[model samples]
Target: MNGAQSLIKTLANCGVDMCFANPGTSEMHFVAALDSVPEMRAVLCLFEGVVTGAADGYGRVAGKPAATLLHLGPGLANGLANLHNARRANTPIVNIVGDHATYHLQYDALLTSDIVGFARPVSAWICESKSAQTVAGDAARAVQAARSAPGGVATLILPADTAWNEAERPAQMLRDIGPAPVSSQAVDDIARLLGNGKKTTFLLRGSALHGAGLEAAGRVQAKTGARLLCDTFAPHSEVGAGRVPVERIPYFAEQIVDFLKGIEQIVLVGAKPPVSFFAYPGKPSWCAPQDCQFSHLAHPHEDAAGALAALADALNAPAQSSIRVPLQLGGLPKGPLNAMSAGQIIAELTPDDAIFAEEAATSGMPLLVTLSTARPHTHLPLTGGSIGQGLPLAVGAALAAPERKVICPHGDGGAAYTMQALWSMAREELDITVVIYANRSYAILNIELQRVGATGAGAKALSMLDLHNPEMNWVKIAEGLGVEASRATTCEEFASQYAAAMQQKGPRLIEVMI
Candidate 1:
């Protein structure tokens, strides 16, 4: 068997059956091997970012690693932004990055660059396969690294010669490595805090934000009267009307401080202590009150679900009554076709089971608040704080959960970054409803300029923020990308277009002229 064949077998044995790829010449052997392997499905992507982002979505839903096939350093570089998001989410991903043959390194070809340097920032574990005999074993190690604990990105760089060379035998498949136990001392401290009876919050994150861990948090909250909050930035949050309703900590520092003001203790479960996004003038980095005692009940790498279950059992916390209620959307203003404001459109456009991919920047804060009371849905925010991820994430999500309607309520500035994803949506006939908040400028940058105390900006400095010497023609762009497109100037048109897009089978775009 060839090294590439054995590597593919290793990946399949480790449960990574899906591969999202954007290949190059160096990866031809791997690609050929993938074609020969019947069980593995390789999804092609025009951009590396889409491949990585799709892998993130698959891992979040599939609860295992999805392999990514990227070219050399430049290809890996292209995918790094989404890898950042995946790492932040703790989504398991095995990356197979192709490299120059061992003998070709001294020649310093055009594609030759610091692939390992590029990978180290985003990957939790990285390895370079030296020979064909070791390539399959290296791939197996990559899968294990990705599957470790709460999950993370693992990269295996394979030289062209290594992939093409012959392997004597296939690598041994590895067994499941269970999560590390929560610290006994940490659990004891949390027990003491609960016994004290002061207002405490057990903030959830990582896998603890889903399924049984959520239920355990609900039970604990019901018994102790402590509020339950999710992490400020989560990889994937499993929230709905019927599930234990978890309030996420606000992104704004002052808002988080206000939220945590009365709480004397904060116990973490697969979450870190809340902190400010940036250190503003005279503001603290950490959001908790002066006397708030911080403790970790379980680390991110621990078995968060098991730990929470154990805590619930030890305390004998009763199942929450609120956990089994039907979903309800509160009364929202409608009917008048006034200014097609963000608030009005949000209330009118939201559906019962929509998956919201929001990278709406500043204009959507009001939308976020309003939609919190809207029907139950999976809300995916830009977790890594990167601007361009929303569009690609929306595409991947729509493809992954095809049965559920997907909504890409995107900020125009951020949407432009991965606007190419619209083409993929069109090609795949994904059920995606994209609403572009075309405010004609980088609205968030204006806010940042003010925050950093930069004042008296001239027309030239201000001009850089504007997207309109000629305003962006999003409808034109969408149509060019092979998706059905429309423009909306009024609330009625916005609502009509949004509803129409939701009902359609293929990808559709509505450019809301805000």
Candidate 2:
């Protein structure tokens, strides 16, 4: 067998059956190996960013790792932004980065660069296979590393010679590893804190924001009068009617500080202590008050849901919380095409079990609030501050769970960063509905400039954030990419387009001119 074939086969044995790829000359052998390993389905993406982001989305929803085949150092660099998002989200992804042959390195090839340096920031585990004999085993190890504990990016740098050379068989599937066991002592301590009668809040992330963990948190909150709040941007969480609701920390530092002002204590469940996204003049980076006592019930690498459930059981908490959010479908507003009306339309019409991969930026906060009372669905947000992850994330979510609908509600400026994802959706025939809230500017940056005290900025400075000189015709863009598209200039038009797109299957785009 060739090294590339064995590597693909090993990945398949490890349950990473899907590969999102944007390859080059160095990766030809690995690309060809796809035909040999039928168990691995290879999906081509036009941009490396899409390849990485799609894998991120797939991992968040499928609860496993997806492989990404990137060209060389530059290709890895192209995908690094989304890799940053995946790292923050703790999403599992096995990256196979192709490199020039071993002997070719000394030649100082034009494409040559420090691949390891580019990978270090994002990868939890990284290796460069020296020989064909070891490539398959290395690939297996990459998969294992990607899925271990809290899950993360694992990179295997494969040289072209190693990929083309003869090799032994594929590696056997490694032993499966789950999240580390939650500490019993820690659980008991948190239970006592909950019963201490002090005002406390639970800061949550990871699995604790969804499914069983979420339910346990609700039960704990009902039994004890504490509150449940997730970070401003969570990796994955089940929200809306019938589920235990979780309030998200506000994006602005002042808002989060004000939000956490009165809480006397905080217990973490698979989450970090609240911190501001950025430092502001005369503003604190730490969101929580310094006097508040803090404790960890579960670390990100531990079994958060299990720990919370045990805490609830220890407190003899009720099976269900009385604070479950009730269904509140809104009557669509007919006047203006704006964030509030558009948000209500999308929220009220969102189907159960749907997946919303969102990077709506300045236009998303109201939508997030409205979505809390909509149908039960999984929500994936930009965990890393990166803006371009939304469109490609929906691609992976749809592929991982094709039976469920995947919606990408994106910002016009950020959406431009990875617009090629639309082509992948059309090519893969993924069931996704993309809503483009085209306000024709990087509106968030405008707010940021003012917040940062950049007063009296020139027209040239403001022009950098504007997108209006040449307005993006999203309808034509989507059509050119092989997806059906439509435009909505009014609230009524938006309601009709969004509703219709939701009812259909395959890839569809709706541009909301706000």
Candidate 3:
């Protein structure tokens, strides 16, 4: 068998069956080998960005790694932005990048570039296969690295010669390394800190933001009265009714400082310390209070759920979660269809077990408060402070959990970056409802411009932030891409269209004209 055939078999054996691909000549052999392995499902994406972003979504929702196939250096480079997002989210991904034949590298071909340098920043582990005999083993190791601690991108560079050459049997799955346990002594130390009279807050991420970990945190909070908070843009969080409330830290530094002012100690569990996304003039980068102490009971790669559970046990916590968000609904808006009204309509209509992939920019902020009390669902936000991830992210989430409906609330500006995802959604006939918030501008950048102290902005400076000389018609775009769509200008119109979309199942788009 050829190396590509063996590699595909090994990947499937390693429990990675989904592959999002945008390949070229160097990867033709691998593409051809897909038919040989019936287990590995290869999904075609029009753009490399969508390939990587879809992998990120699948990984987050699937609780495992998903493979991505790219052409070469330029192709890997094309997908790097979403890879950056995947890296920051700590999502597991087996990124397979094809390169020129080993013997032809000396000729300085047109596509020959430093693939290693291009992939290094985003990959937790990277390697290039030297020959067909070793390619299967390389694939096994790549899967192991991707599934390792907190999870991350593992890039395996398969040379063209390595894929086309003859190879032997597929390698067996490697033993997955699980998160380290939080020592009993460490748990005692944190338990004591929590028992103290000082005001404390739990900064949670990763596994701590959902499931058993979240339950344990709630019990501890009920016993100790500690506050719970998560990062501003959480990778994946369980929100809405029946889940413990995890308030997100505010986006701006000043807002974060105000949000966390009274906290005396911060206990981290698979989370980073509070810090600003970017440096601003005269704003503190570190938003935590001066006297606040910090302790890490569990690192991002450690057993956060176990740590929280142990801490709860040590504190003699209650048997059940202290308080949960009760199922509730608010009145719908009637006149104008703005961000607030849109959020209300979405929250009111969202069914239980739905998934929301949001990159709604300025338009999504108003929805957060209301969504907290909506039907239970998973919320996946942009973790890398990058735009253009929401649409493709929904594509992967829907594919990963086909039984659940996926709703994407995306800004017009961000949606343009990877709108090709819509075609893939239609092609796959995924159950995704995309709501494009077309405000005719990069609304977030306009706010940032003033925050950064860029004063005296003229028409030219302001023009750079605007999206309106020609407004994009999302309905036409969606229709052209094979997905049925509609446009909504008033609150009554949006409420009707969105409610109808939520009740049905195929790929659909609703342009929320602001």
Better of 1 and 2 by lDDT: 2
lDDT of 3 by residue, 1-514 (tens): 9999999999999999999999999999999999999998988999999999999999999999999999999999999999999999999999999999999999999999999999999999999999999999999999999999989999999999999999998999999887888899989999888768999999999999889999998998888888999999989999989999888898899999999998999999899899998999999999999999999989988999899999998988898875998988896789888898899889998889999999998987887877989999999998897799999899899989999999999999999999999999999999999999999999999999999999999999999999988879999999999999999999999999999998898999999998
Q: Best candidate per TM-score, number?
A: 3
Cα lDDT of model 2 by residue, 301-357, tens digit: 999999989999999999988888899878788988898888999997878999999
Models ranked on TM-score: 3, 2, 1
On a 0 to 100 scale, what is the lDDT of residue 63 in model 2? 96
Per residue, candidate 1 scores C-alpha lDDT tens digits across 1-514 of 8999998988887778888889999999999998767878787787899888878777776688889999999999999999999888888899889999999988999999999999999999999999999998898889988998878999999999998999876666676565888766666667777998688888888767777777777777777778888866676766556767788788777889998888988888888888998877766788889898888888888888778777776777785534542454444344443223545566555767777777777766776665665666777778888778777777767766778888778888888888888887888888888888888899888877777678789999999999987878999999999999999877667767777776678889988777
**lDDT for predicted candidate 3 compared with the true structure:** 0.94
2 or 3: which has the higher lDDT? 3
Ranking by lDDT: 3, 2, 1
Kindly give the stretch of ten consecutive residues in candidate 1 with the minimal lDDT sum: 331-340
In model 3, pairs of residues that clash are none
List ranges where model 3 is wrong by over 4 Å. Answer: none
Pairwise TM-score winner, candidates 1 and 3 = 3
